[model samples]
Target: MDITPVANPALDPVQFPRLEEVEYLPVSTKYRGMRLALWGGVQLLVLAICLTPYLIYKFGGEESMATMSAWYWPVGIQAVFSLLWFLEEWKGFPRRGYAVRERDITYRTGWLFRSTTTVPFGMIQHSELSQGPVSRKLGLNHLKLFTAGGSGNLRIAGLEDDEAQALRAIIEARTRR
Candidate 1:
């Protein structure tokens, strides 16, 4: 191998074309409400897990009242965390959306730390459509798109089941293998 420098063809590296305009389409309107409910359900489950053990110990007569009081600090911290989680999830719920174009799919997500990802169809390895117990009950499905050499690029949650199926079919038709 030679350690020689090669000459550049273009005079400047920043000669790419500039964008004329930009447009973004939002996800289904029901997505935000569905996400909020899912998060609230998770917080409730976490709350129960946090309090149940201490409640059992206190009411079951396994520990003295004074000893059982030790659970307060831990439970308090968990409650605070659950409240913060609720707030964040609520605020972040409306910030997610996606778009599918001729050659790729774009998903935009996040509130505090935001990101826009575009996955080219030719590079997509495979895709999946799934519904969790809660999402299924809510008539929602999640679409996951996997690229050849990367982790899950698109994981759009809270889509209607039939819409997810249709989108999966479209992308699957464009997938490499």
Candidate 2:
């Protein structure tokens, strides 16, 4: 048997499909509330921890004016940082979205430094659905797709319960084929 090497043909870039042109569906609006509840709880917990030391010092009958003044700076800095972080999440939520095509699924995220990940259905080994306490309370679910080989997995969060289940079913059907 003789194996002949075929001539390589150059492909035109213009013929390729444009990912930016694909219509992406935004995540559920309830995601904002879930994020606020989750982050707000976290911030409050951290603030409480930070204030514990100061509260102990003051209530322990050894209150120093210097210590009280010192506490303000650290707590103030933390408060400001948390506020900025929350704002980032709020502003960036709209930019987070996903698109499911007949052959693949794409997820785009980030506000400042954007990222887009696409996973073909043929490459998917399995998928899972998950929800955190806040997400469950908000009726939101996260769909995680695990691809074959060492390729990275993809997670599409902030989806409504029904939407996530439908998407999971679609993925399951596609993978079965």
Tell me how candidate 2 scores on lDDT.
Answer: 0.89
Which model scores highest in lDDT?
A: 2
TM-scores, all models, native as reference: 0.69, 0.84
Which residue runs does candidate 2 get wrong by more than 4 Å? Answer: 1-3, 12-15, 59-61
Each candidate: what lDDT? 0.75, 0.89
Which lDDT value does model 2 have at 90?
76
lDDT of 2 by residue, 54-149 (tens): 999999998999988888987898999997888678788888999999899999987765889999999999899999887888899999999887
Which one is best on TM-score? 2
Residue pairs with backbone atoms closer than 3 Å in model 2 (clashes): none
How many steric overlaps are in each model, in order? 0, 0
